[model samples]
Target: MAQSTEAIFIPHHVDEAFEVSYAEAAPDFGPLARDRIPVRSMAAGDLVALVEIDSRITGRKRVKYFERKLQDALSESDVRVSLVAELDGVAVGFIMARVDLGEFGRVDTTAVLDTIGVHPDYQHRGVGQALISQLLMNLGTLRVENLRTEVDWNDRVLLGYLDRCGFRPSQQLCFDRSLG
Candidate 1:
């Protein structure tokens, strides 16, 4: 069978904003043996798993901090979380987002995909693309206007992914400092 690049083997449903119902249920996409990459909401109990994967893929120093923040963010009614490519209930990669229903000072409401990471062990396996594409599709489904994410210069893989999602690199800098 010709596999689908975008379709996940685990079973997934889209109701109100794509919040996960239960990790206990079979993945909406399908079996990992079929090479399908499933992206599902991450649970607070999954924090350690999230941190370990994120640190390796992002090459960042503060894995625990970010993981904790993500867990905290998920607690809010306005926030949402997602994970990707689970070999079986274990999280292989993940994405988390915040859908601010309130309009920004001068901007419309937005779905900010705070983080998306595929464990270094699973890079280049289309997990990252699947997760991002899923997130963008969800945003479109919600009729959101603006989407923004911060990317480090060192994380070129992520920058490239954003570009593929039709996000441009803005030339404007909010602030900068010099140590001279």
Candidate 2:
């Protein structure tokens, strides 16, 4: 793992059939399923299925809005969103991320994992892990300085996963509310 003098190992994850050349990243990766689930970086064709899954799971489905947003994000160079884990070629899980090569405050540049979600029925399986790993791989390919995610303080499962994936507590938090 000898990197150049300025080369830094940015924390990232992968979500699909990661090439074995990056076996070391395997620790942060997981199988989508044992021959049952097929992991993939989603494409435009999956719009319908993803919408259906959302409606069935959360009862709050907005297909066209999301489709437009996805299309816009992909059209942008600074944002790199990778959709993951489609069982039977149907969209079941996804990871959305952004890769920015601009400094936040003092640091140079970074990639941030914005959102990741799997259908509730598909929970407990490794779909989420696979999605995460895949996103990290994408970030690595871009030479991102680091990968970051904003987590709800109460999401213990997510917190544990991020810890296992080698993220540290880089900042603290404060909450605010506005009332009329």
Candidate 3:
């Protein structure tokens, strides 16, 4: 896939705002070993696998959601950062992410971790870690400054996993207003 060539700009006043760079703040974890499972970029052919894995995890099939996610990953963004994990030739996990060249008035290059899912049978394995490791490596090459994700407050399992991956609470608080 082609990459964007636009110059990403960061506000000069960020330091005065006490903003922390995700790249510098993240703890240095040792290199990941990809010997066990093979992680690769998402492809148009893997749509079925992604849908299947997600369905098994959430206990319902959200076909349209996964379809749109896959489409966005493959065509909507300038960069393709989403990934899939396979074992014995079958897809067992997936992580879909996108790069934001800038948002609001700030122009820092950041990646948003949109959706991640591992088949029920593959939970507790190193599949998630491998996916995350590969993602970090990819982001580093593109000079992405940070990775951000949102999790429901009640999702203790996911929160614990993110903590283990060295992700801490973001400095900015998120506020949402319901339109309903």
Against the true structure, what is each candidate's TM-score? 0.66, 0.66, 0.82
lDDT of the candidates, in the order given: 0.63, 0.65, 0.84
lDDT ranking from best candidate downward = 3, 2, 1
Instruction: Give candidate 3's TM-score.
Output: 0.82
The count of backbone overlaps in candidate 1 is: 13
lDDT of 1 by residue, 47-67 (tens): 777778877865766766876
lDDT string for model 2 (95-118, tens) is 766666765354556776765667
Query: Candidate 3 on 1-180: residue-level lDDT in tens?
Result: 123354545776776657654443333332443447789999999989998998898888888988898999999999999999999999999999999999867799999999999998988888888888888888888999889999999999999999987788988888999999
Q: Which stretches of model 3 miss by more than 4 angstroms? A: 1-30
> Which residue pairs show collisions in model 2?
13-133, 13-136, 14-133, 14-134, 15-130, 15-133, 15-134
